[model samples]
Target: MPVTEPIRVGRDTKEELRRLKVHPRETYDDVIRRLIDVYRKCQQ
Candidate 1:
């Protein structure tokens, strides 16, 4: 697996992410992948 650097999110966004249970152990890629799936479904 290609290791990517941590994603820097804005303070407001970081709080929302934490509320959503995305922690340091989770990669931004995981978040983006889920978003993409929902986006693709919406497009369809």
Candidate 2:
């Protein structure tokens, strides 16, 4: 398992992440990872 670190975000950013979820049970980690993968692909 990866070591987890806590980070802070504005309430608005948190709401945006919630809206970006594909499913209710998905974790923030999963959403962020998906976004990072998309960004890396675009950069390439």
Candidate 3:
């Protein structure tokens, strides 16, 4: 398994991420990747 490091976020920030998730079970990595894809599409 790949090593993972802990990341810290403020309470409000964490809440925002929870709301942004497509599904309750989605990981933070998935949410971030999806946001990046949307941003790249907008930039084009």
Ranking of models by lDDT = 2, 3, 1
Estimate the TM-score of every prediction.
Answer: 0.51, 0.89, 0.77
Ranked candidates, highest TM-score first: 2, 3, 1
lDDT (10s digit) by residue, model 2, range 1-44: 99999989999999999999999999998899999999999999
When summed lDDT is taken over every stretch of 10 residues in candidate 2, the lowest stretch is: 26-35
**Highest TM-score: which candidate?**
2
Candidate 2 TM-score, true structure as reference: 0.89
User: Could you tell me which residue pairs clash in candidate 3?
Assistant: none
C-alpha lDDT values of all predictions: 0.73, 0.95, 0.90
Strongest candidate by lDDT: 2
Worst 10 residues of 3 by lDDT: 1-10
Q: On a 0 to 1 TM-score scale, where does candidate 3 land against the true structure?
A: 0.77
User: Cα RMSD for candidate 3?
Assistant: 1.3
